[model samples]
Target: MKWEKLGLVCTADRFGVDVPTRVMVPTPVFVNEDTIRVFVTVCDKDNIGRPYYVDVDARDPRKVLRLSERPVMDVGTAPSFDEHGVVVAQVLKTRDGKLQMYYSGFERFRDVRYKIFTGLATSSNNGESFQRVKTTPILGGSDYESTFRCAPFVIEFEDRFSMWYVAGSSWETIRGKQVPRYSLKYLESPDGIEWPVEGRSCMELQHDEHGFGRPWIEIDEHGTYHLYYSIRVCSLAAYRLGYATSEDGLNWVRKDAEMGLEPTPGSFDSNGLSYSAIIEAHGSTYCFYNGNDFGREGFAVSKLIK
Candidate 1:
């Protein structure tokens, strides 16, 4: 697949936030035929993230329609699983007409530097506010993943939910900071909730890979699975978009060379591009993603170069 780069869409300052911060992971939620609401992770000066939403025209996604006055979901209390930050990974509408949000709860640790766990929230009102179902994490993988089980993307088919998330498999000490090593994993649930404690490995880690940022999937008309994610290398210290395809969701192959997206040498996204969110709307395909500085530089879009 090919993409046409579009520049930055939203900055935290537009939301009345301070400078030197970022707005990352702009995932689109279709509000209607003409409008789309992009949910984003807004980083604070402290480098903590909170989920926020902004409305944009579907015909021209860069135009701002509205912005959330406050965070749709905030960080948890002290000593809580998400005390440090909460990054919005996926939001899906259940069969019962409620929206379910799967997020990565951030926790800072002295031993490991940080740990991320999966958590859930539900929205009764369209796409406005959400309430946490519980404080405890919904995902508990192996000890390797004890430090991270995040970036969950779920697709419900036949009334059953299938999830693809990034799970840490190792930790590497890099220049005084603990960086995690992870790969893509999969799980199935009879309901949107109640997944097994562990997930089956989908995308294995490559020798040159440290971890993936987010895994996004979409079933094409031909029933082939399209997976888009970010590849992080410890040496690069930044992310670049990658892609894969599968006949069965369980088995996969990487096609990063075909992803056709990279940072522009002297652009806002030049530092890095990660946390990709793709949507098919208004007769076109567009991808929203985070740029350099982990979105401190803000979010941008890329149109399918069809």
Candidate 2:
């Protein structure tokens, strides 16, 4: 596989607010025949991320159409699940034609620096705004996820919704900083909102990987599932993309070297990459991903060339 870089689209600096430090995790929502909205998590200097979006022309995804004025939704109020921050991952159009949003909430703890959990929101106004399914997370601190559960991507088949998410297994300290080591896990729900607390572990870390981030999947016409995720290289101390193919969503064959993406030298992504989002338009499949600073430098798009 091969990809052609399309350059950066929107940046956190465009917000023009109090130090719009980062813009990460480019998730898309289809609006109309000519419009496709790309939702991203914009963070402040303090590292508190809130979800924002920009609309682009359907024919050319790199062309900017409009930018969201305020956050689609704010962080949960104090003593709630998402007091610290909210990062948007994936958005899916349900069978009923309504938009369903999945995001990860940030929380702090004494033992660890922070924790993550998955939450659900729905947009009836066609991705304009959303109302939370509930204040508390539907899946977190479950049997498989010892510390955190986050960066969820979901797909639906009939009455069942399939989810691929990252869950923390353990923690390792590197140079006096405790970094979380996470593995990929799977879950299913009758409806997109309600999910089981316990998930089945499907993918673990490689010998050189310390953790994993958001998992995005694409189902081709042949029904083959292709999974893309970001792994933290312990030695390099930077994130890189990985790939795999699954006959069933449960079992996967790893092929990270074939992911067809990497940091472009002397470019914004030169340092690392994370949170892969793919949008197929025209005669090309485009991938939107975060660069260095976990999005502080902003996100860019890549066109599939091979």
Candidate 3:
């Protein structure tokens, strides 16, 4: 597949919102025929992130319609799972006509830099407001995934829900800095809420790659699966997009050379890009993603040309 790059769309500091730092992750969900709300996480001076959104025109996604005045849900109270920050990952509409958001809850620690786990929230008024189902994360520390379990993306089928998330148990020091080492994993749930204690490894780090960021899964009409994710390469010291395919969701074959999106020289994404989310509307397919410094300049879009 090929994509035509569209420039930066929304930054945290652009619209005069309270947050003044990064706009991480552009998770878009169709609000209507004309409106696609891209949910993101905006950070403050302390680097505490909360979920916000920017509404864009579906046909012309670069055209901004509105922005969220406040966070959909605030971070959890002190000593809670999400006390440090909350990054929105994926949002899906439930069978009961409510919206369910899967997010990575952040918490800082002295021994480790931080721990991230999956949290869930529900919205009934079309995402204007959200309330956490619980103060604790639904996908927290388990025997197998004791350290980190985050960046959850779920697709529901007729009988069950399939999830693709990043999980790891250890941190590694690379280039004299401590960083988390994780890879893409998969799980299934009868309901969108309860999941297994462990996930099956779908993709592991290869060669110079040390970690995997968010994983996005797309299913074609013929039932072929396409996976888009970010790989942290040791040589480059940055995140780059990788692609894969699967006959069954559990087993994947890497196809990195085929992921046509590349960083533009001297652009906001000159260093690298990550956290990609794909959506289709009005006969067009789009990939929304973050750029250098983890989207300090917000997110951008690319339209699929092939």
TM-score for all models, in order of appearance: 0.95, 0.97, 0.97
Sliding window of 10 residues with minimal summed lDDT for model 3: 11-20
lDDT of 2 by residue, 89-174 (tens): 89898888888889999988898888889889989988889889889887778666767888899999886988989887578986
What's the CA RMSD for each of the models? 1.5, 1.2, 1.2
Candidate 1, residues 1-306: lDDT per residue as tens digits? 778887788877887766538888777877788988888888878888888899988998888899998889789988888999888998887767788889999898776668888999999886799899888788854554667788899998886889999887568866666689888888898976687877788778787678898888889999999988998866777888998899998798889988888889988887788988899887899999988877877788889976
lDDT winner between candidates 1 and 3 = 3
lDDT for each residue of candidate 3 in 1-306, tens digit (9 for 90 to 100): 899998899877864556578898889998888999999999888898899989999998999999988899999999988999999999988777889999999999999999999999999998998998878888999989988999999998889999999999899888888899898888999988898999999888898988998888899988889998899998888999989999888889999989989899999999989988889989999999999988988899999999
Each prediction's number of clashing residue pairs: 0, 0, 0
lDDT, model 3, position 2: 96
TM-score of model number 1: 0.95
Once all C-alphas are superposed, what RMSD does model 1 give against the true structure? 1.5
Clashing pairs in 2: none
> Order of all candidates by lDDT, from best down to worst?
3, 2, 1
